[model samples]
Target: MRKSLISATAIMLFAAVIQSCNRKAETPMVHPDFETSYWIDIDLAEHPVRGYWRQVESLDPEEVSDSAGIANASRLLAEQYGANKLYVVYHRQFELDDARRIFIHWKTEGERNGLEIVPTVVLECYSEPSAMNFSDSTICDFASWCVENVNADEFGIYDVYIRQDEGSPQDTQMGILREAIGDKLVRIGLQPGEDLNSYCRSGVEDTWTAECQGLDNELWANPDSVDGTDLYGRKLLASWVAERADSAQSRRIVWNMIPVAWDYDKPVDDRGYVCPGDDALINDPPILGRIAKCHECIVEGYTDGMLTEKFGGYSCDLHILQANSAGHPDSISFYRQLRNGEPYTGYFASAMNQVSDLYKEIATFKQAKSKK
Candidate 1:
C-alpha cells in the first residue's frame, strides 16, 4: 500500500508539471507588423509562435548628455509626464529571409456574366526572407526577434498592390506574384482604368501588387508619409496604437506618431511615404485629447535622425501626454510640473505611497482569507 501511494503521488506531480508548462505557453504574446505598422495580440494556444522582434530604446535618459541640445528633453518629458513610469514599445523591421519563414498564399475566384474574376489574395504568415548575400545587412530578421523578446500578442505585415496602368485586375502582375508566393492568399481585385502608377516606381509592379491584396488583415493599408488621409495608411496606425492598451502600464497609452518629414531618397511608395510634417499629427487637436480618452498615449514619431533635435527627439514631438481625472489627481499636478520644466519629485513620492498602500491592502486581504 505504501508503494502504491508513492506511485500515485509521483503521477500527480508529473501531471502538475505538464499543466504548469501548458499555462506558461498559453500566456498571451504581442506582435506588431512593421509593414502595416499595427499591434496585435496572439494567444499562443490559438496560433503558432513562429518568431518576434525587439523595440529600440527611443528615449534613454542616459543618452541625453549635459551637452546635448535641449539639455533636459528626457528629464523634462519625464518631469511633466511621470518619466519612471512610462512604457516603451520597441519593434524592428522584417528581414527578407524571415519572409521565407511564413509562406501561406490564398486565392479565390468568382464568375461574373460567364467570366471568372478574382477579387482578393492574402499572404498571412510569411517567414523572414533569406539574405541575398552574406554581406546583405537588413533589419527584417530582427522583427521576429523583437516580437519574441517584447512578448507581443499581435503584429502587422505589409503587402503591396499594383493595378494595371490601363488594363483590369486580370492583366496586373499581382496574380503572378501570388502564385509565386504560394496557394493560400486573399486577393484584392482592382477596377479597370485605375491609376496604377502611384502604386510603385519603374520595374516593381510584382512587389507592390502582392502587398496590396492583403488589406483585410492590415490596420493601415497603403501607409504614405505625404498623404495622411490615405484610407489605409496613417489613420490605421492611430487606431492600432490605441487598441494595444493591455501591453502598456495601467492607465498609460502608447502613441507611435511618425515624424512629419522625409528621411531618405527612396521613392515614397517604397517606405510607406513617411513624411515628417505637423499637418499629419493625428486629427485630434489640443494634443492631449487621445490621452484624455485613454489612460496613456505613447506616440512613436517617424523622423529619421538623432532624436535630440528640437523636432526630431521624442520628448518634443512624440512623448506621452498627461490626462486629468478625479481618480488621478496627482497626475494632473504632475503635468503642470512637466509643462514648467520643473522636477517631478512629488509625482514619484505619490507613486511610492500608492505602492505602499497596495501592499497593505493585499496583506489584509490574505490574512482575511487565511481565517476563512
Candidate 2:
C-alpha cells in the first residue's frame, strides 16, 4: 500500500465492496459513488492478491490471436471467482475485435468478477508497437473511453521506452494518464529490477512521482543461485522485501507485485516453462512472509500450460495437481485434480484464499507496528 493509502482509501474500499454486491445482477454495474465511473476496489493494501485472480490473463503479442477466446476466458474468470481483480497488461495494439472484446465484453465480465482491471498500456514499450500514441489524446481517449463506456475499475500505465524533453518517458506518460483518467487510480508499473534507492540518490532534480511501484516478479525474482549481495533467491527474497519495505516507507511507493514467471534458471534467451512445485516459490510461511511485506502483491500466474485450452498458456495449477497425483519429494500437492474437479481457475481460487489469509495476518501486524 502507498504510505497514505490507509487513511485515503478506507472509504473507497467500503464503497467498492458495496458495488461488488451488484455482481449478483446480469447487467454490468456502474459506480454511482464518485462521478459515474465504475466502482473499483481500492483496498489494494487490504487485499493481498494471493492466488487466483492476480494477472488471471494478459493481452500480449505472443498470446493466441483470439479475441473471442480471450473474452470468453475472462467471462469465466468472473463467473468462477465472483469478485476479484483481473490484472491484464496490454502490450500490443487492439488487434482484430480486441476493442469490443476488451471494452464491451471484457468490461461486462469485469463487473461480474468484481474487477479492478488495471489497464497498464505499454504502447511503444513492446516490440509489437501498440501505436497508442496516435496523438496527445490517444492514451487519454482510451482511458476515458474505458471509464465512461466500459466503466473500467482502474487504469494503469507502463511508461513508454522513448524519453521526453522535460521528464523521463515513464514520468511523462504517468502525468498524461492521470490527467486523462481523473480520480480513477493511475498506478505506475515499474520496470523489472528498478531500484527506489537509485531514484532517491540521483542528483537529477525531478518533481513527479507515482504513489505505487509495480514490480513484475514473475520467475525472475526467485533464483537458484545468489548474485553477489543481491538478495534475489527463494531463501533471500524475504531480505529483499525487507529492504524494499524500508525504501517504500521513506518514499511512500506502494509495492504492487505483478508476476509472470517464465525463467529462474537459464538466461533470458534460454528460459523455458520449467518451474514446478516449490522450485519457483516455497508455498510456506516464509514465502508468505515475504509477500506480506509488499504493499500489494499478486500470485504467480505460471499456470498457462494447464489453462492453455481455456487461457493461452503457464501451468502452476497443473504443476500442483501433478505434484499431488504423481507427488514431489520436497513439496505437498495441494489439489487432487485440476481445480479439485473444477478447473485450473478453481485451484487458484482455493490456493489464493488460504495464502491470502496468512498474508493479511502478517500485513496487518506489520502495518500496525510500522505506525507505532
Candidate 3:
C-alpha cells in the first residue's frame, strides 16, 4: 500500500508541472515600455500617399475621389489623431519682412463630422535669401528676433526654419540655431534639399546639401525626403498651442505656425490630391522619444519664462497620428468616422487599446516604485 501511494503522488506532481508549463506557454509576454528606448526612425519615402490609398480603397469605396475629398479626409484624420489645426506653409521667392502677412486662400469650407474645421494660413518669412551667405550666428539672431517680436495674440505658434546655406554643415547649423533660440522659443530643423535618400538613410550616408533654393520648392519637390523629426516637432508645438487656445482664462494666445512647401498655380496631381506627399510623420517609438524631449524642453522653457511671461501654467497632451493621402478609400471613410468622434473600429481601435494598456502598466509601475 505504501509503494502504491508514493507512485500516485509522483504522478500527480508531474501532471501539475506539465499544467504549469502549458499555462506559461499560453500567456502573452508583456512588452517593455515604449518610453524605455528609442526605436526606428520613420522613413516617409517608404510609405507614400498612393500606397495608403490602395489600403483605403479596400476598406471604403467612395470616400476620397477628388481634391476636396482629400483635403477633408486629411483634416479628419489629423483631428482624430489629436491634431487641433492644419496649416500649409508658404515660402515665397521674394524676401518678406518678418512682420509681413500673406493670405493664402481658405481650404474647403464646411462642417464635416459635426466639427467646424477651418484651415489656417501659414506664411514663411526669411531674414535673408540663401544668396546672402548668412553666417550661422546671423541666421539664428534673425530668427530669434523674428520670434521675439511677433505678436503672440495674432500668431498662435511660430514655425522658424533656419535655411541651410551653401557649404554649411547641417548639424553645426542646427546646433547653433538651437542655442541662439535658447529657451525663448522652440524651432525644428528641416532637410535642405531634394535627395531624400541622402538625409533619410541610416549611418554616415545621411547628408544634406543646401543646393535647394526656396523652402517651398525643396519641400514640394522632395516631400519624400522631408524628415519625420520636423513633422514631430510641429505636432508637439501644435498640441501646446491648441491646449492654450482651449483655455478660457489664459492671458497668452498661441497660434499655429507651419513650415510648408506651397505651389498655387500647380494643378492637383493625377491622384487629385493637394500636397500629395505632405503627410504628417508617423508617431513610432523613436519619434515619440523625440516628441517627449521637445515637450520637456517646452515645459522647462515655460517654467523659466523663456517662452512667455504672461501664461502662468501651460500643459499639452501628445496624441499625434499620421495618415497618407494615398491611402485606400476605406481609410478615408475610417478617417471620416474618427473625425465625427465615433469610436475607432478594427485595427486602429485595437492599437489604441493596446496603447492605453501600456499607459496603465506604466502608471502601476510608478505607483509601486513610489511606495518603496
TM-score winner among the candidates? 2
Clashes of each: 100, 13, 20
Off by over 4 Å in 3: 1-173, 183-321, 324-326, 332-338
- Superposed model 1: Cα runs more than 4 Å off: 32-332, 336-372
TM-score of each: 0.20, 0.42, 0.26
lDDT tens digits, residue span 274-362, model 2: 22333333222122233333323211211221111211111011222233223234433323221232333321234433334433343
Models ranked on lDDT: 2, 3, 1
Q: Candidate 1 residues 1-372, lDDT tens each? A: 999999999999999999987865543222211111111111101121222211222221111112221223234422233222111211122223322221110001001111111111112212343111111122223333334432122222222233234343323333343233322222121121223222221110111111111122232333433444453333443343333322232121122222112222333344433332222222112211222111111223212111212111111112112211112344433334433455444423333223223323333433444454
Per-residue lDDT tens digits of candidate 3, residues 18-120? 9988865543222221121100101112122211213221222221222443344344333443332222221222123321221111123212322222211
Over the full model, what C-alpha lDDT does candidate 3 score relative to the true structure? 0.29
lDDT of 2 at 158: 40
TM-score of 1: 0.20
Which of the predicted structures, 1 or 2, would earn the higher lDDT when compared with the native?
2
**C-alpha lDDT of candidate 1 relative to the true structure:** 0.26
Residue 38 CA error for candidate 3 (Å)?
13
